[model samples]
Target: MSTEPIDGAALLDEVEAFHRRFNVFPTEAAYVAVTLWDAHAHLLDCFDSTPRLAFLSPEPGSGKTRALEIVEILVPQPMMAVNASAAALFRAASGAEGRPTILFDEIDTVFGPKAGDNEELRGFLNAGHRRSGVTYRCVGDGATQNVVAFPSYCAVAMGGLGHLPDTILTRSVIIRMRRRARNEKVEPFRARVHEKQGHALRDRLARWTEAARPLVDGVFPEMPEGVTDRPADVWEPLIAVADAAGGAWPARARAACLELVNASKTDDKGSIGIRLLTDLRDHVLNGIDRLPTVAILERLHSLDEAPWADMGGKPLDARGLSKLLRQYVTADNEPVAARNIKTGGGVLKGYYAADLSDAWARYCPPPPESPLLPLPPLPASSQP
Candidate 1:
């Protein structure tokens, strides 16, 4: 290493510039988030948790794999894998050489429906977020068998089609990739020429991280409004790195944090129960105070392109709806169960609008604000 001083902020600028040269990220925030994530990996020992970097999209050729390839050249001891098993990952993560920066491509193959169950790998991904996280396994044979705890903590990045499990998704800085448009352009990544450049930047990042680690180790940078809990934990290290760098990065980091976090909120597909609640608020309720069970079912079944129309080859029945909603509570903290509602001739089993309020408020996005229309022109005679 050189004995000269390093300018942390300028070094980060170079890293960000390098990414822009090869990758057309979805937004400016994606660039900032990925840059900070690269720097944070070098300072992993300074923080209690490291957020997983996830690049996901609905289709192929959207640069998901390219994003991981870029990350591979920037981080320390990069271990790139595809279709790797849990046993293999565990061995790699616990290798004596130190925790490798695990970059997984085609991660959907490990967690997607066609791949079947991978509980061990899922558990590893979840536990690895925190410093103290570990997994136990039986070692040795028969008489000599002993349960040993293996360290699961490591910096992880993944690229794949579609979504990850909710456990992993919540702990990640997700970049939703999209195919480049006709006019959009980026340099074709040629490893022969670019690998050396990326490696050079990687070296500078490592040097800067060593010098700045002491300053950022325990620093608690302020979070933007509405950023708290798991999102706060996921962003803490990245923001801390930006703070140490100084210059425009501090403001840029916070802005990116808020933007990405809020975007995740909007993009969240949510559970089926939550989806039902949102549909009820947007469709069936329509300002009515109450609705009969049969009436609600009719409206739900009539929705085109909705799962309710052909759920397991049948329309959503009252039993299924009840089962889904029963897990939630009402405004009064009572079970959201159907009760007797009086009709002209007799009573019918139905739901009160009041009972669904709590679930709707908690699970659904706020209604969109109507665009303010300009007031009609004042009458010619009335104009002063």
Candidate 2:
């Protein structure tokens, strides 16, 4: 291993070289390569005693499997590729060297609906991320085989479609792959030649790892603010790896966390659910707040006039609006007193903005009156 430090620019150069040699798109491949390097770096430091998991997912024909093949060659240590089984996996992992990186391909097949056939494997995958190991007895001949326990420290690289099981996803760094553009070209990966190049890169990475490993062992950086939920735990080490790399990676890691890690809450369908809630809250604050179910229906209908109408589908109707609101607000089956109207008609129910103060504060905070609009004269009876 070389004694020189592995800088970000050098890392990028290596990644670009690998991408060209392997015939993978730069945007998708570069990011994955850097992240893998970072993950490996971190494993050497923080989890020198454990294993880590990386999942590469993209739509069909996006080259996830090929990327894994490249990683298998580049990551240092005694690496093996196989479909992980509960017993075999525990056995392999139990004796893995420090900071092991495990690459699993077609993980969806292993954990999808058909995963039921291998419940023990699924359980192992789930428990593998934690700092604890699992134990089970072997049912053998005369005397039951002694129960065996295995260590759960290993870095994983899994590739497949859409998403992984939540259990695994919550603990893995996800790399999204994208299809190569028609205009882009990559050199063919000639095994005889590329294998040598791949080995060279691995040697460089191993050297970098040996130098940086001591700095990261069992130490993790604090997570950035505004990051929440399971992704925080899964990515903490990856970010630390970036930090350990020192230049550019710190920023890149934070950006990746914000971009990919926090992607779960975003919806591509439409803005109707949150927007309708905002409009309701607006109406409430204006004191025109309470409207009969009919009035609410009318306002929704009016949204068809311009901008809102073009948002998605038709403007929400009472039933459609109610169903959508059910996700974030509560309602009752019996008639309830409305702000400005009395109930007793055919309408048996209605909803109020559950909490306008907070929702409005976030979605539609009060804006200062436009100076450009002409102000109405003071009430006729009173002169300014």
Candidate 3:
């Protein structure tokens, strides 16, 4: 860990070296995942966004917690905690100058089913993916009690067994950890020895990031061919880091971005938003000029064994339906806002079929091709 002038590739290499000391990241994607997190941790101020590093494992002894402990030492201004409440995390992130890197270990204990719903924390994590995130909280007492907005932008690294809420996962760069095979071995992480290395590496990374700012600050580095939307957002910083590195790192970074981002997509379950869009296209949008919001809700609720039938123990309503589908189309207003449409019904409002078509084309899967039927009996009498 030298303070002398260093290139981005060398600095990233050092980070990877430090990570490998305590953990055996099962795949190249896994190794790149941690390296990018360490790189992003140091350059948080330079980028508009950063993705949370979610280290999840199927069970304990998967090196998930061990990885977090190591990460706790590498990031700049890390707020490392074995057990921190949502309030503590919010305050820690909001009150910090550069917004601390949150290294939360055993996260499932605080976020799992037994821990009950933590929508606020979930929302907080989700919001932080963008630089514009803010969380409002009521503070003080009596007349002093007024809601204040807190800056929610911060880099988070979390480790746990099993999956987090889908909302949190969507904004994260996930590293699925696993137990090391008998043949694979790593130096046991001793706090005394490892912490010093971690600190030195952090210092080196900090110095390099300061020097490399010009190459990356506010620059939109080119993305891989298929990377777009949220996946593109998640990888922007890493790709920038790779470009700044100026070597084979750029190619490696894109490969890892494509491999891991594609791997994160769930095969068994379809995306909820896409599924909703398909349902609307098939059953609701029938070239009508407009449909009352009430009619849409009724149709959605009529579907058997669907979440809309009894969403949250209450039938899905217009407002709820709007919220789910809102991300696809324009807001209540806008030309492509890119999908807002007319709504009306005396005191109630409706939606235009034209507005929904754009969302259908973008979000819905293609309908299956109709099978051709054999021509009817070839006019049997004519053949005779």
Candidate 4:
């Protein structure tokens, strides 16, 4: 190792390079965010909150575990919490030795179908985001039992098979991992050989963070436009670290923040009601004014990638769809309801386009631009 002091920007560059050597992230933004996260773990005391770094994928062999393993070596007091009980996690994080940087692999098993209720564990993950966050627990037995508060503030990174609970998801920097293509290649990580190199980088990060503490503590870095609310909280520390690092990092960090934040909005797998409204706007409505109940159900069920075909273990019928949309209102403040429409043979119950306009605008993004929209007719003055 060099005897000289560490350069923050150059050290971050080295950390990014180290990750690239062993892991293939889905986007350039993903790599940038991960790099900043690794650096921020060393200086958790300087910030008010620590965003959980989540690596999630739909299928197996997408490198979720490898990402956590790589992070395990680079953080302070790394603790792997797979299958750990809630009480165990609380004790480990609140220990006097130091708050462990919790690395949770196979996290899906904690929240999956087979797993029993894990409300306490979930609460721990949620509350730990803020510096003052804590969990209240009753300890002792009989007359001695008393409630106590345990500090839940700690840096956590998780790798899981599917989505996290909404409470945890809002506080996380979500990386949607994908399987590598045939053309993409990465170095095989061998803990025995590569861990030493990772540790060296980790030590350098520690030194840099020590030097940066005075500059970053209580400093709120300027956020990119449109990044507000929970997202602003989640990205604040990472952006502050980037700003302190100087060089091209401040700009790069802001860009990464914008890209990843916007991507999360578009990629959110929202509630079923919201999904139904979105699907109707994008797939069923088109340019037509109204769709009969039967016709609407047909289009929704035919979608191969949608859950309408098997929602609640059966196809979503008109009654269910009506119940879902009943909560939403029209422009006139009337609950969205099915009205009768006259057809060639008889009057049929269906939804009108005007009634759904408000819900579509409020609950979903504007429909994608379609090429099939007809062009305006030639103006009268210009007509030949």
Candidate 5:
């Protein structure tokens, strides 16, 4: 292994060559290879200090695990594979001389809808990413043991499960994997045959990483725009890695950040949020103009499978529906309010046509009514 500093441009070329030789799908392989290259470079500097994580999530039969296996060969330090107790993980991470890369297969099994199994994993992963090492009590021979601290800076690669725990997801660079089509074929990866080539590429990458260390450490780039909430945290290091590389990486980093993070944000699992409710309310206002309490309730009930069906703690009954509408309507403009100006019952108990006018214009614009639209006729043979 050459101890000389790496040429970034040359390193990239080596990566491309190695990828073409063994990598099956260029698109998926390119993404994973670039990410690994970037991450490995970043880890060289302050390898003991910085904590980082990458997630490889692909559809079933996608080569995510195989990609990680390739990654293990490239990174300098020995990587441990684990699917066990959080304590054992922390212990191993703490004992490593430098930040050890931990490859977690099927991380979602520990964090997905299984409930209790996810909590400890979540806690440990969260703690491991912090700048300061985490401290926990160890059980010793007798009485309570003293507090033991574990290094927080380590690189983690997780595969299996598309959705990760929100905490880990926020702190990881996500690589989406696609299944191989029938036509595309790659040579079987043999460790002995490819080992030398992989090592050469890794050595070059390591040297370049050393050269770029100063830049990575000095410039901690801000999170890309449009990456809010949990995903922002996850991509931060990856973005930082890209920033260190310079050239077109800065722009590419931001673009990838926006694409992946924004995609996750747009995944609406039928949850009730302001946008959904606003749309639903606008739909009702445009169709019926002003509706009575029962009419509104019927409309809300009709939308049982919609977002507003179970909004505000119940299945939007008359009272609950009226309460929600009252927030937007005014007494003077309502029909009931106009008829019984003195009585409290007649006061705008629900939404009025004028109250929804603005919302209608904004959310559900009026479409021109069809004139003499013809209906579909029965089959010609049947009609005859």
Candidate 6:
């Protein structure tokens, strides 16, 4: 191996250029931007602790698989698998040289209606992110049988038609892919034609990694303030890799981390069930003992951008509202009880705050604590 320094900026540009030549992924700047760090991840000693890259789409022919193909070209010891059993993956991930960077395609099928068949493989994918992640399985015949510890640490890039399991998605840096538009254009990938150039880039990547590994292993790049917990663990390696790469990569990497992480949060909040509970607790039920359906619906519909207004093919009704609230109740037929809450017309069905308090605490983040003392009304001059 040559001892000369590598041009980190040039190498990063090459990664971005190669990725763009084949596809235009939705949320491209949020996700595709950091894939360069993923490519050269082997340079970091704790690359095993890095998160997996998930390429997800609502439909096929959206360039998801093609992007994984590109990753296979860029990553080290690439193991491209359209389908493989847990046993096969476990054994392959073992042996002398070390973990193979797994490039998995058609990952959605693994969790289809017959998901029971692939739980083992799913477990493997989830556990493979950290160094301590391992699967214990018996090997050899009856007399020789012994439980062997299979190593499950390696970089992974997966492409599929829909979302992965929540556990797996949380551990991944997801790239949402979409069909190309009329104005977009890209080079059609043919393995025979492109593998040569890909191999050349891969070799240079390997050389740079070999020379920079020690330096990268010793450095811990500063994380952005909003990033912490699992988000911090997942983005740390990418940031470190970017820091090693130098130039505009550090800025681009941090921006992608914040953007993608926030996007994931938005996606979670967009779920109807989550929004219902959060809105109920924060806007409708806070400090109140109970609220009738009419009052609840009024408050729900008034909240900005809430889904209740158009839920169930029209405005949310008593039955639909009851059905939604039942998820938090956890008992058969114990939904929003039909208590007669006082109203102008007379009495109507409503929900008691005690019933919802448990669900709110279990599912939602604790609301910001109310101030101990109410501030005096603002002066007329100061009020906007």
Q: Count the backbone clashes (under 3 Å) in each candidate.
A: 0, 12, 4, 0, 4, 0
How far off is model 2, as Cα RMSD? Answer: 8.3
Tens digit of per-residue lDDT, candidate 5, span 71-153: 67677764656576777677766774666667787766676555334666677777776556574756566676766666555
lDDT of 2: 0.57
Model 3 RMSD in Å is: 7.9
Q: What does the lDDT come to for candidate 6?
A: 0.76
Superposed Cα RMSD, model 1:
3.3
How many residue pairs clash in model 3?
4
Please give, for residues 1-384, the per-residue lDDT of candidate 4 as tens digits. 566767899999999999999899999999999999999999999999999999999999999889999999888889987888778888877889889999998888998756855898999999999999998988899999999999999999999988888788889999999999999999999999999999999998988898889989999999999899899999999999999898889999999999999888888846778889998888888678998999999999998789899975899999998999999999999999999989998999999889999999987866777778798999999999
TM-score leader? 1
The regions of model 4 sitting more than 4 angstroms off are: 1-5, 114-117, 285-295, 326-358, 370-384
Cα lDDT of model 3 by residue, 1-384, tens digit: 445688778778888887887788868877887787788777877788888889988889999888888888888888887667667777888884657888888889878757867777888888777788888889999888989888888899999987787777777888888899998888988899879988988887778788888988998889889788888888999888888887778888989998888788632124666767766777766556666777777887887755678765788777677777777654334332122344442444667666777777766656645568777776767896
lDDT score, residue 300, model 5? 58
Model 1 / residue 134 / CA error / Å: 1.9
Q: What are the lDDT scores of the predictions, listed in order?
A: 0.90, 0.57, 0.78, 0.91, 0.57, 0.76
Q: Which pairs of residues collide in candidate 1? A: none
TM-score of each: 0.89, 0.63, 0.73, 0.85, 0.65, 0.77
lDDT of 2 by residue, 1-384 (tens): 345567744664475467556546434434643444534633543552232444454567787777777777676554455666767666666764553566777777776645534667667777666665554546456686665566655556667766565556556555566677887666766778787887777776666666666766676666778775466666666666666677666676677667665453341112445556555654333456355666776666575333344334575556665566555423333322333445666443455553334444444424435558788889978985
RMSD of 6: 6.1
How many backbone overlaps does candidate 5 show?
4
C-alpha-based local distance difference test score of model 1? 0.90
